[model samples]
Each structure stands twice: as structure tokens, then as C-alpha cells.
Target: MSLKVEFDEPKCVAAGQCVMVAPDLFDQRDEDGVAIVLDDSPSPDQYDEAREAAAVCPAAAIRLVEG
Candidate 1:
């Protein structure tokens, strides 16, 4: 299985929910509060958790695609 993660900067509200949910796959830059995608292409073990983080993002900034 292949999974992809994408984050939209403009739409992000810096809620930090994504980072809070999955710190391994997401992060917060010191300059900007907006969440950043650490490993947009996460490993299989992180797939479900990454998806969960995406789902919990209040700004809906995370996008996941499965293949």
C-alpha cells in the first residue's frame, strides 16, 4: 500500500491538532504556528495514525491518499 500526505499552508489555522495527534508525522515550525508535514510519505506502521491525525485536524489541512 502507498499513502501520501499533503498539507495546505494557507488553510491551516495553527491549531496544532495534527501535531498533537501524530508528532512523528507532523511538526510545528518555530517561525510559524502552522503544522508542517514531517514525513508526507509515512511508513506503513504510521499509516493509520497519520490518517487519524488528518481526520482530527480542525482546519482540515491534511490530505491523505491511499494506493
Candidate 2:
């Protein structure tokens, strides 16, 4: 199974929860503080962290899709 991380920039509320949970996969822009997806396709071992990041996002901007 492969995991993909999707981020909705428009829906993001500049919350850093995703980055806090999964720094390797998520980040915040230096200027606006909007969440940035560092890795859209995460490794299998990082699947749990990816899911956690999505779950912790207050803005519901993060999504994990399995393909």
C-alpha cells in the first residue's frame, strides 16, 4: 500500500498542528504560516505519522489517500 498526503491550501487556517505532528511531511510557510506538504508521497513507514498529521489538522486541510 502506498500513502499520499493531500493539502488544501485554501481550507488551511494557518494552524501548525500538521507540522507539529509530522514535521518530516508537513511544514509552514515562513511568510503566511500556511501549512505546506513537504512530501506528498510518504514512505510506508511514515504512514502512521501522515495519518496523525491529517487528524491533528484543525482546519481539516490535510487528507491521507491510500493508493
Q: Which ten residues in a row have the lowest lDDT in candidate 1?
A: 28-37
- Summarize candidate 1's per-residue lDDT along 1-67 as a digit string, tens digits: 8999988888899889888879999998888788888898999999988999989998888899899
* Cα RMSD, model 1: 0.8
lDDT string, candidate 2, 1-67, tens digits: 8988888899999979988889999889999999888899999889989999888888889888898
TM-score of each: 0.93, 0.95
Q: Give lDDT per model, in order.
A: 0.89, 0.89
Candidate 1 runs further than 4 Å off: none
Poorly placed runs, candidate 2 (over 4 Å): none
